[model samples]
Target chain A: MVDLTHTLSPEFPFLPVEGKTFPFRSSPIATIKGDGVYANRWELTEHVGTHLDAPCHFAEGAMAIEAIPLETLFVPLAVVSIAERVATNPDTTLGAGDLMRWEKDHGEIPARAAVFLHTGWDVRTKEPGAFVNMDGAKTMRFPGFSDKAIEFLLGRRSISGIGIDTLSIDPGRDKEYAVHKELFRAGKWAVECVANLSRVPATGAFVFVAPVKVAGASGAPARIVAVW
Target chain B: MVDLTHTLSPEFPFLPVEGKTFPFRSSPIATIKGDGVYANRWELTEHVGTHLDAPCHFAEGAMAIEAIPLETLFVPLAVVSIAERVATNPDTTLGAGDLMRWEKDHGEIPARAAVFLHTGWDVRTKEPGAFVNMDGAKTMRFPGFSDKAIEFLLGRRSISGIGIDTLSIDPGRDKEYAVHKELFRAGKWAVECVANLSRVPATGAFVFVAPVKVAGASGAPARIVAVW
Candidate 1:
């Protein structure tokens, strides 16, 4: 068993959307010394940390976080690594050619699989500034799956979803977020900022994308686990 | 697969702790109509709808929500139905004798299992008035596990936790919450207001109590699931 979630806190890096920042915050509401029990009040953006993006995040009139089917939550995981390329070029994307090569070596991508791009990006998680690396023009840099790669997975492989070990499934420099649209338009979900993909094998392991059942929300932080 | 989670919303029944009420709230921060992508900001108390109580919730120095070991999350689910008894007595409690009877018929309770008391309380979820069932003196009435039952499970079986289909693992009328203290003191956890427990079998199905990894918080809402 392995946990692929980041511990959500105010200190964790959050993506600024449209110049607005919604950070994760928690404060003690009850304490053993004060109230004889412990609990917290938490506030967060739906997309922070290791979270699952419901189809409604980008696709119009799609299912919200609560409406996602339970049957699709458990899925076969296919790990495709781009760490070697990402080590030299942080701007690299896992293109369609990579998926083809993966199928050539590992037979065919299984049905109902969540193909995760292991960019080795989680190595920078501890260093917030490095994790959200931005160039001189204020554009972030990280490896992600190419839109064509996502299209192939959706059209040919019949996958349940795609996951990535980065801030977004689209390469960080992407301003259009075309990949998110493609995936959500097909009513498929996604996971972002996934951790410890290196521990999982290329195939055989299954994952549970268990997001908190928030009603009518675009997404929520999830506790994703893999078991064989 | 069965999702043992209740969708969290502002309308859900939340247990008031020491006269404080923390309600779940979600509002759209970005909408597809304006922002092209959709998302929401959510605020919640950790103990709200379908939540897990980390050991630290009562045990002063026990593990927090983020530090809970992954090994303990995947557990063999042992469903012990008390729905029949609860049908007549709304304030019924599942006693230790019930556990003995369960073992006599199904053999010894398995190690590392989550034993759930299905009280059929979820049928009243749509009615907050009856769900909380507060009396003139402001005392709530619901089904829960008896402290003796929890003590027996902790001592005799290497169990992960105890769960209930009602507002708490302790009887709703319990002012002292003795059952909570007994279970938490043993470094075990609990789930409250779990949904769809009746769909699970007596034994054989394994569950994953996947709580959102809130950093250093006492507990968090969990999306628990069972698979056969």
Candidate 2:
């Protein structure tokens, strides 16, 4: 079993929204000394850290996080590595060609599969700013799925969702969020900022993309794992 | 696949704390009208809904939510139903003799299994006040595991955790929480307020008790699932 989730906390940098975002924060709510048990209260934006963006995140009147069928959350895991290219050009993406190449080596992307774009971006998570890769404070640049790749998966394959080791399904500089709209428009979910995509192989593992079962929320921090 | 998680929200009744508990609350942080995408900020206490209680929840220096290994979270599931007894005696417990009867009928309780006490309490979820079954103003009447049953599983059987359909692993009326301390003392976790235990068979299902990967928190809302 491999945990693909980041340890969400206030320290984890956020995809900036007007120079600020509600990062994950924890406060002591109970203690063994007083309440006979230790517990906490948390406040966080639904999209922070390793999380699943429900279709409702962009598609109005779509499935909320709780409405997603449990069977859909359990999918065949497929990792498409663009890490080698990303090492050289930080703006790399998992394109349609990359998916075809993966199929050539493995097999066809299986039905109800979650294809994760592995950009080796997980390494950048050690530093707050590097993970988002904000260049000169103007536009953030990191790897994501190309629009063509998303269309191919939705139109050609039988996948349940797509995931990435970056902040958003669209490239960091994509102000329009083309990929988020495309995927959510199909009523599919997206997993962003996954921690350990490298540890998983190209195919064969069963993945569980589970978010906190928050009723009617856009997204929530998720604990993603793969078991072979 | 069965989702053994309740939809967490403000309307869901919490395990009342004094006059109030920090119930799961969501506020729109972004929207298609304002931020070009829908999103919400959530505030929740760790133990309010379907959740996992880490060993550190009671024991001072035990595992926090993040420290629990992914391998440990995946275990064989065993549902021990006390619903028949609970129909009449709402405070009925799954005791040591119950384990003996279960093993007799279904064979031995396997190693590293999650034995869930199914009290058929999920049907009461339609009315929040009825689910916890607070007896007037005195106690909350609900089924849980006996200390003998917990110790039997801990000392005799090699198990990962114990779970209950009720609000806690110890009966709600037992304010001292004896079962919680006994289980956590041996570094075992607990899954409380699970949604659907009766749906799972007596054995053969693999369980995933996953909580939000909140850094250094005692517990968090969990999305528990079973695949038979």
Candidate 3:
């Protein structure tokens, strides 16, 4: 049993959007002397941390959290670690060849599996500057998917979704977000900000990426877990 | 595999508060979109819909969402259905006697198992009005646990936590919230607003309730599933 979701708090570094202010604050709902009790009060964006992006985030009429089938959310999973490669190049993008090599080393990715790309990117979460990687140009730098990699997964593999350790499935410099377009167009989902992938076995575990049944929203925070 | 979470939407009701109001309403992120996108933007109180309450919800310095051990969150579960009784009384509360009778029918609840109480209360979710149950008095009436049931579960069972099909673990009319205190004091967590427990067997299914890793959060929306 391993928890792959990241902890969401006020301290969790959020995605920096230029010009627009991000709502990322959470306060404890204090108890009144004569009133009732309910503990926390959260005031933040839907996509704060460890969240899932629905097609509607980019493409309209895509599947939202509630409409995604339960079977698609819970499936067999395979974790392919590219930590060493990502450690060397923060802007590194994983491609199909990389995943093929991973499959060669581990085993075939089963049908209906969630292919998790473990880049060891989450270790830097505590260091806000490093995690978000805000540069002088105001653009961020993070390891993500190569356009070809996403295409390969959807076109060739029998997969339900792809998960990554970084904030976005596409590189920070990717303004087009081609990877997201491909995955969403293919009727698949993406899980982001996953942690502790190193703790999971390469295969034989079931992944549960249950997002909130938020109606008509583009995306929602998901609490993903892997059951062995 | 059937999903048991309520869809959180703009129309999905939340616990009311006596505070200054705003004309602009931020809609909840719709969970499912077509063509493989789900919830791009979600807005809700942490305690809304299908959620898990950590001990830190009321017991400060206690376990936060991330601090609770994975073993505690991912244990084997036992479903104890009180739906038949709840059908007669919407305010029916589960007590020790109910649990004892359940044991006779389904055998003893194992130590550290997640005890899910299925009250058939979720039928109202199809219609928002009955789901929130806001009447002229503004008080919600729903099935939940009696204080005595809370004491019995904590004192007699080495259970991981309790799950309920209603909006809260306590009766909506509960003023003191003794159930919350009793469970939190014992370092137990909760799964609320769960559905489809009636589809699962009374025992043998494993309940997975993994919430977003919210730091110091009393609770967060959880993606719950059952594997038989």
Q: Cα RMSD to native, each candidate?
A: 1.2, 1.4, 3.4
Lowest summed-lDDT stretch of 10 residues in model 1 chain B?
A: B14-23
- Give the per-residue lDDT digits (tens) of candidate 1, residues B178-203: 99888888888898889998899898
Indicate whether candidate 2 or candidate 3 has the larger DockQ: 2
Summarize candidate 2's per-residue lDDT along A85-195 as a digit string, tens digits.
999998877889999999999999999999898998887876988987889968999988999999999999988998999898898888888998999989889899998
TM-score of chain B of 2: 0.96
For model 2, the superposed segments whose C-alpha errors exceed 4 Å read: none
What lDDT score is found at residue B71 in candidate 1? 86
Best by lDDT: 1
What is the Å distance of residue A217 in model 1 from its true position?
A: 1.3
lDDT of each: 0.88, 0.87, 0.77
lDDT of 3 by residue, A42-160 (tens): 66666778877766666667776667778888899998877897878888888899889888987878999998888898887888788888779988898888998887888888899
Worst 10 residues of 1 chain A by lDDT: A14-23
| Candidate 3 lDDT by residue in tens digits, B75-169 | 77888877887777777888899988888988888888998888887877777678667657888888788988878878888899999888788
TM-score (chain B) of candidate 3 = 0.88
Give the clashing residue pairs of candidate 2, or none.
none
